[model samples]
Target: MAPHLADWRGRYVGSALAVVKPADTRQVAAVVRACAAANVPMVPQGGNTGLCGGATPLPDGRSVVINLSRMNRIRSVDAANNALIAEAGCTLAAVQQAADAENRLFPLSLASEGSCLVGGNLSTNAGGVQVLRYGNMRDLVLGVEVVLPDGRIWDGLRALRKDNTGYDLKQLFIGAEGTLGIVTAAVLKLFPRPRARATAWLAVPHPAVAVELLGFLRARCGERVTAFEIVGRAALELVLRHIPGARSPLAGDHGWCVLLELTDTLDAQALDAMLESAIAAALDTGLVTDTAIAASVAQAAALWALRENISEAQKIEGVSIKHDISVPVSRIPEFLERAHAELTAMWPGVRIVAFGHIGDGNLHYNLSKPDALDNAAFVSRTAEVNRVVHDLVASLQGSISAEHGLGQLKRDENARYKSDLELELMRAVKSAFDPRGLMNPGKVL
Candidate 1:
């Protein structure tokens, strides 16, 4: 490789035969053709910040890594059609800013936006803060230009809102985690930038109460509810303890907390007032126990900083086992109650850090030792912990992986949860696109 191939978290280190940086789509096609001729597997890499080890190559050193960082380019911006065509290696933040410059919005957002690539986002079908309002990358995409496993280029980069000409091949690669092909560019949809945004932090008594308040707020706010994130008391505590200058919005510890935002095409102050009134009504109805509405832009950012910094704070604490899972929104309370009870009972004194996009039914459920322990010892029980949590997710008809795809991290675990019939179909599709199994081998499949 280019010295090394490491994941964003540095948990996965892989070796490749060589890392080839392609400067354009034609160069990407050439790289793919060469790899295909040699019957060699090709691992497509973007910004290399994926949490699921999706971008990391196998350790065998048999694959040629196709690094797309050099292909970063904004091909065109069609403000009239509300779409933008960009190369895969462009940072997500850059894309958002470019859209904003045109008075448009590309609302897919995550904490790693500053470093993550739009192509990687498309490959994982990334869901982020605005998933509730703008949907995931899959829904935001209009077309994709991909280098198929065999080196042929499928240029479906049409920026049309409606194209019912034939089967939508773009959808296959959107969330396939790069198993079938390497996405080089994409035509993505955009929206008019929200004229106003109102954010509030609320303290709730329980997960059940948080779920209720979400429904209540949505009933009043409708699609304007841009984001609804839930933070457990323990999660918030981790932030305050490890993240400097982090302050709790509420005075006392609550069982659960929500960081909510409402955005609309209206006056900023009016939207803020509307959000405040909604929270007040929820409090009157006992759906919310306490609340803190942002009074200034800086104050609002500080509140978000706390929620966004939880992952980093936990990392500072120590190594921990983590899961990205999702269940029905209505079943979130039951999932949390049962998961916590069973995990705590099994591993007494285990610290469970549960928090994430409750509005989208996804949770970043994590576990760490209550006191200092060998990292190896803590990691050894990952399978046992996964058995309990994923089994429960299976029973609830939920997903073992929510936003993060089944990269090397959960490849085998996914085999356990997904039915043979389902996996067979997935394999069949993979074969249809890549009979040689060369594109991003050992991932998703």
Candidate 2:
């Protein structure tokens, strides 16, 4: 308790009996054993940047917070094997830099990469702008070394690409949100760094056009379409207005805008020309309304900054009700249309900010009122808003919690969406791995 109790986003504030800083896995295991012997709950925290309140503990003061920041280390970098082993506490940016040093790439990236820990990224199975190409954190991870709740170390850290062994145990803890165990370290997959990239900001007539354009680009460029993101007009306006010096990528705001990124292991000049011709073709066919291609690396990053700064802009605007729901790519247009119509009819003057990795059919649908209200009033309506949005997600056969795990925020709601049989099997696995339930409790079943 020397530094202070953790308070993140001004939402979760918990007092820890003692905040333990362990230097390594052995120290973590010993701390876990001591807590288990005393029958005290242990809340594992990393970076304290999670939006779902997973890293924050309860206010009851019945637990000791085990912060993983001190365990930062790059254990190994096997360039030939195409894998890198890093401790759980290493910052994600640091991991990416390590991979870069070896002429490889670690593609798990988010706006919080500078501060978020590798352990937290794995725990949540984070999917950022690049998920459409690299998949989520779960896919990027090859193996993990976890310390069980009972202080037993399960070392499954293997860097092999093709390991079809019985029951991939690494998965259980990867997205478990630390409910099952403490992820002490990870063996992550690395890819040959894409030698060249081409980026463009395109204007689409509607969400349907965005979806069709995504399909079009994929068929033409195939795997080279590394990132395809959609930004609604309102969402874009927020960034331009709130974020300083944020200029519009395109001339005027159409119905929607899409940021397309193409990366290849081939020549940069060829890729740029190819993307330019592709965009021109798309425009001729009316798939695209307008377009702006980045002329330099700085311009490309600026285009991406417009998309990445959406969340930060929203936060600055005010506390809004946010939902990270995803539907199938084919049904994205329908879902957006129906959700917007229904919600607008019910709640007038509600500003809806819809945007995300449309390539993955995941939209960060958030709500804020034009007329400001008190925090309590806004929060009190959360259940109602959730019912409307989540019910539609269910109707579309989509997931309520997409990349973000159900860390206390959506845990109960997820139970409702999942089948009884599925919940039973999950509980069985939890019991088998952590019988005493001394691990991170009140999270993800």
Candidate 3:
């Protein structure tokens, strides 16, 4: 119960009446029915790896935390259909392995895939590095099987690619963060496994140049440009300083760097040659300051490790303000320029650790406390910092909670940016699916 009552970030702590682990869907339905009869709320949780505290129960101890760890199973895989059914508690890594066993690819990857569950991914509509080419969890899922608040199973797990139904009910629960219902299982779409991959660590003049590089690579290489991530100089330094064995991939420091990857089913030699040609042209055009192409699989993984370890490295550094934000790809540079200027004006010498999937316009913008300030003093100014950043996001038609769902952390902040009509519509949907409001109360809406 104690473990289930806290979030992965340890930013939120909660309590629950009891932690219930159902072995199967039938048992889950029974537990849900019992809770419904007693009017006891429920918080459906999977893996408990969410950063937003969406799966944590409330401190009131009025709800039961339904932990889905016991329901871990890969129900079936249809290779011909390029789809697989996974139970709610199945680890994301397990699902990926299942796809690999069938010689297929499940491209919904994240740093937490080793521990995060597929249900949580679906519920949050998670986005990852591959989202630039593969889209998010919502795009990867073909259908969902959810359990209504009243303990009724809605078996909507159809694997059809073309379904012109009157209303797509599964979508209502996809990104609802369990406010609507409990997603018990999902039908995940798969793709052909790539035979060759080319990874590079590149130094860029600035974020704008990184954006230009992305466009240039896309124009020439097309969909092979699977991932394009940007890391600020400050971010890379933190990783190199904190993470063991982390080394700089380039010869010299630059203002910004990008971790780009290209994947294809073509021959490995041809793919590597194409990547080399692209990097050579970029160098000739002065788009890249320096670059390092991965000579082996181990080197490619090392380059990816630098980008993936940013969050962990920051955690080891100290407490700081964090934001997952996004704007139009064209406006990213403008957003960064304005945000840095405003944040620095408010709190001088605040270390900005900005990095993320620049190809998809999302950035994990974080701020480290200045050396002169204490942790408590810097953390106390969270609201002021949020106002400065979120307001700018609104001005630029951006989202404050881009990939991360608006759990308890950003629910109120999100309301400030959304219009009255938009909030009203969202509330209407909530009421429609959960009239009694017994499904994960105090989350999302």
Candidate 4:
């Protein structure tokens, strides 16, 4: 009960009459059938690592939580077909290990991969650092097995790469946040493991240069540019202050930095030389001020640790307003400049910690409290801060909820940005899927 009632962020604490663990898809269907017969709503949860309150049940204690942790299993792995079937409850780390066992790569990575479940990742359509190359979770999945609200199991788990017979039903359940159905298993796409890799930390002049540098690398290195992430000065400072053994890759403090990685199936020496040449060219163009290329795998991991520890460091710092938003890649610099100017104007000395998958245009724009402010006061201003940030995102033709889904946290806020026709269509789809609305309620509506 304790574990199922709270979300990963600790911002949402819910209540449930009971937490039930189903061993397999048939058991899950049985539970769903029983709940539907009894007119009790169901909340389907995976690892419960969602930043939004998507997996947490409501506080009314009227719903039954279906925890999928027990259904952990890797059903099958077909290396020849480049696909693997995993149960909904399997931790992302488990799935990665399975892929690695076959000498393959499952490129959906994030800070919470160790504990986050595959079902939750598919439901949220998670985007991570490697999204610049491998795409999001939605793209990585070829098929899904879902248990609908009426207890019927839709076994659409096919590993085929192409099937244009009709409407893509799997897409509906992929990012539906369990509002449509409970995903029990999935056929995930995999790729050949990279034989060679190169990582570098570059200090950029600003966000604009980071964007230009991304284009520069992509044009020359092509798909070898696996990831390109941007880190703000404030974000790096927080990591240095809080995380042990964290060290700056560059000599001097830079306003913005970029973490780029190149991987190839070719020789390691050739990959390193290619990456070095690209960096040298960027340096000559003044796009990069200072740089640090990892000579060893350990050093590369350490450099990645700096980007990965931003969320944790901020948690240790204090309460703050957080937004997962995205805009056009070209307009990233403009968005940052406008957002900073507006947020500071509203709250003087407001600490803005902006960092994320800049190659894909997604930014984890967070606001830390001023030194003089307290926790409660800073949190209380969440609504005001969201308006300032979300409005800018909308103006730039961006999404309010980028990687994180619109759970209870941003449900209403999302309505303001969506067109009436789009909202009506979404509701129609929800109603069609779960007419009685017995599936996870108060989520993505």
- Name the TM-score of candidate 4: 0.99
- Evaluate residue 408 in candidate 3 and report its C-alpha lDDT on the 0 to 100 scale: 90
TM-score of 3: 0.99
Q: lDDT tens digits, residues 269-355, model 1?
A: 889888988988998999898999988889889989988999999889888899999999999999999999999898877788999
What is the model-wide C-alpha lDDT for candidate 4?
Answer: 0.93
Clashing pairs in 4: none
Q: For model 4, where is the 10-residue window of minimal lDDT?
A: 369-378
Q: Write the per-residue lDDT of candidate 4 for residues 327-416, one digit (tens) a residue.
A: 999999999999999988877778899999999999999987757355467678888889999999999999998899988899999999
Of 1 and 2, the candidate ranking higher by TM-score:
1
User: TM-score of model 1 relative to the true fold?
Assistant: 0.98
Please give the distance, in angstroms, between residue 410's alpha carbon in candidate 4 and its true position after superposition: 0.5
lDDT of each: 0.90, 0.88, 0.91, 0.93
Per-residue lDDT over 1-445 for candidate 2, one digit per residue giving the tens place of the 0 to 100 score: 6333553456557776888989999999999999999998888888877877787777788888898999999999999999999999999999999999999999988888999899999898899889999999989999999999989899989998888868888988888888889999999999999999999999999999899999898988889998999999989988998999899977765779999999989899999988988898999999999999999999999998999999899888888888999999999999999989988897766788999989998999998885556544755789898999999999999999887777778889898889999999999988988787767777788
> Which is superior by lDDT, 1 or 3?
3
Q: Report the number of backbone clashes for model 2.
A: 0
Alpha carbon deviation, residue 403, candidate 1 (Å): 0.6
| lDDT score, candidate 2 | 0.88
Worst ten in a row by lDDT for model 1: 370-379
| Runs off by more than 4 Å, candidate 1 | 1-4, 374-376
lDDT of 4 at 292: 98
Against the true structure, whose lDDT is highest? Answer: 4
